[model samples]
Target: MVKGIIAYIVTDGNGQDAVKFYEDALDAQVLSLQTFGDMPENPEHPTPPEAKDRVLHAHLRVGENELMLSDTFPGSSLKLGDQVGIAVMISTPEKTKDVFGKLSIDGLVTMELQQTFWSPLYGQVQDKFGVTWQVSTLTQDE
Candidate 1:
């Protein structure tokens, strides 16, 4: 069984200017910034020299949470759509609902607050920047 929380899915984009934007806007500290060229074990990956500058793995510290950001490798297809959204699961329904409402100011609300079969409170929205988000409060039974 899964014993630990490794990471969460936030946004999977081209991530061209995302690193700088996140660092500035969120005041996030980059813990580890690595690139494709830095990984020596994957020699067969065939990463171009220029692409080495692209972010392979970046850990950003935001408040109490560590947000990760990375760029998709060449030839990898990870497109954004309505079905896919960055899920942010909070511990409490109050905070989760508040965040959902705050993020929905200039965003679109695909789903309103309601009790899910798995969680106590659940909602979905797309932020102003075209990033989708799913806010949920996990129940003890889940």
Candidate 2:
């Protein structure tokens, strides 16, 4: 089952600043914020010093919808205009895989569906129309 769709905003390196701006400007209430430094230390892939302070994920509530934000890792290929994407929250890993596979048919699969620290199933794809989508199963907290 599809839970909800969220607008995810990605910043180059100043996600904290953007969060503050939205808090004041749009009166968004931040539910959670995690920086790259907050991630569990993975010896194989260390968090770059420049990205340690960058937001890995932020969840905010505005009106009745959800607003998410994050920062690209240092030296990532994410461009300014492509920073905005849609996140499709699914109810189960099975449903998430179905949706992700369908979305990746003619689109580019940026990240294959796989388990991550935050979700049981998570992936990213850019549709044929060029809109990026992050598909994932909702976590317990979500």
Best by lDDT: 2
Candidate 2 positional error at 129, Å: 0.7
Candidate 2 residue spans exceeding 4 A from truth: none
Residue runs of model 1 more than 4 Å from their true location after superposition: 1-16, 41-43, 81-142
* 37-133 per-residue lDDT for model 1 (tens digits): 6666555766777567666667678777777666666655566553234657677888887888898999899789898554698777779988777
Model 2 C-alpha lDDT per residue in residues 1-142, reported as the tens digit of each score: 9998999999989999999999889888999999999999999998888888999999999988789999998998787578899999999998998999889888999999999999989999999888899999999877
- Candidate 2 lDDT: 0.92
Worst 10 residues of 2 by lDDT: 74-83
TM-score of 2: 0.96
How many clashes in candidate 2? 0
